[model samples]
Target: MRRLGSALLAVGMLVGCGPGTQAETPPESAPSAEQQQQAPILTTTNVDVAIECSGILEFANTASYTLLDRYLPSNVVTNIVNRRATAPFTSLADLSSVPLVGPTRLKQLEGGARTMDFIDADCVGILDGIAISRDDQTAIVNLVNTIDDSELHDVLPDAWNGAVNLLNTRPFTTAQQIADTAGIGDVSFRNIRNSATLSRPLEALFTAINAIPSNGSYGATTLRHFDWWNIASANHYYRDQKECFGLEPTSVPYGASIRPNLANAAEVRAEVQRAFDYVGGNTKVSAAVRDAGFANLDALIQGRSFKGCILTYENDPWSRNTVHIYVDTVNGFSVMTETWWAE
Candidate 1:
């Protein structure tokens, strides 16, 4: 993903007495003893960026104003300074402490830290090894759908060139789709998959505390049952990628951009029990759980799987107490938290 190349051209002006083009420095200005003794410890063609978790933490805690200003927006740098004043950042997840720092900004910060070194030793960060985040999915989908000849060659190595021209057809759904289209051999298939994965966008993950309903009863229920990662992803955040406890929510700038916080899922059995309790405890909830062959909340939690339910409250104005459950494979167990608030 990182490539380095540079070119230097020098032209020497000859003096009146010189037949060959050779420029010599005047003896007096040639070198000073002190200046000659000074040696640079590092040399680099480009800035060294830190992509690892610890490296990012170091940058957040120690980066100077000049360095921060070079990469982050002025307002964001101010927010970072203000937050750091309260406490030094503890983890990559603590990035949520700085407002306007999300997927995009995180990428900039990761590759922004500079050092006088030719190679970056801290570029070991990856989004996720086993599971792909939403950002990863979007980037991969885009790349496969729109790779040009040069881009295709650049992404895949020489061994994969055989399968390169075969990808001219548009819109590939998965690695398997490309393999099928090209009728590539096993090696080509493996190469394509590896390239696709390596080509996914690399960004630092911050623990994004998902917004819950203002009603405390509903909020507690949502957290206790549903997977936090699932909820954060539903809110369009990349979380649960790291192990960090007690993360704080970022402060949104007043009169700035504000997006709606919405989460929805299907076949939520145990996840909906507590919410159902707050809504006068629906019988369908129990029936769904029972029908799923789970005796109680403990059983459902221990060995939870997909289960559906449809609840409609006619008397209530908000949501009209309507909860519709369809078959969703995105997450096995999830709860829908829909909150409506005014400015």
Candidate 2:
């Protein structure tokens, strides 16, 4: 009876352990959509490893300079480091041409060592626009917003007043009326008017006057009427003319104590005719002629120089016909009259 009972129990246990008797299959681990989408494809350590390995592979080419340094032998962990000991790398190209670093190694190095944290730290902001080449040193920094003419007057009111005052005091016979109409101030206008006969250009005289700040050191009087008018006018009018005529206008010699002798009206007229004749014949005088004219005028003045010549000529645009006046000191003439009629 006992043996028969043992046999039945063993059979029962084996029957319970059959294939279908295990717990219902763990519901098939099916990853959720979000988990699959957000999983990190690569780790930071993996990236670092890749870059280091690639750098080692491309050591012969890209890192020739670093390889030649003292740290290379001690730092290199590879057993094949002795192979590079005889690297006859005189130049970067020679190092790159080594057969050990082939295309496959080059590609690996390019991809892995494209960016390294240690190397990148040194390169931060290296490629900014502020770092210009030496040749581009004079490049102008363009202003985003430019000042308007109207705003300029408001910004520099004193300069405007100085300019107006200077203009008002100029010594033309019609200056007072012009000044009055132009709405120049009394005190400022009077000062300029009194000083106008000093024979300097109005602008230069003003510049000299204005150079004395409201509270500043005074200097010796240097600007004169001739300095103001003839010299100054020549400077102003001939600026554009100099470029057109290919002549260089020089600065006025203030230290020279020379006065221009006034040429008679007849001689002045003849000179004017000569200029007109040259212009009329050539249609345009060469730069050489213009330069010669300056020299001739200087010689004619004998230290004293006038601004312009005064003479009447035929009225035609094509024909150079107008009155030229020598207003500056070299010529006795003090007036320049020009008349133009629109056809």
Write one digit per residue (lDDT tens) for candidate 2, span 136-250.
1111111001222322222223446544433444433333232343434433332222222212232232233324322222121211122122332242221112111111134
Point out the worst 10-residue segment of candidate 2 by lDDT.
1-10
- Model 1 scores a C-alpha lDDT of 0.36
| Least well predicted 10-residue stretch by lDDT in candidate 1 | 200-209
TM-score of each: 0.26, 0.17
Which pairs of residues collide in candidate 1?
A: 267-307
lDDT of each: 0.36, 0.28
lDDT tens digits, residues 185-204, model 1?
Answer: 44443333333443111100
What local lDDT does model 1 show for residue 147? 44
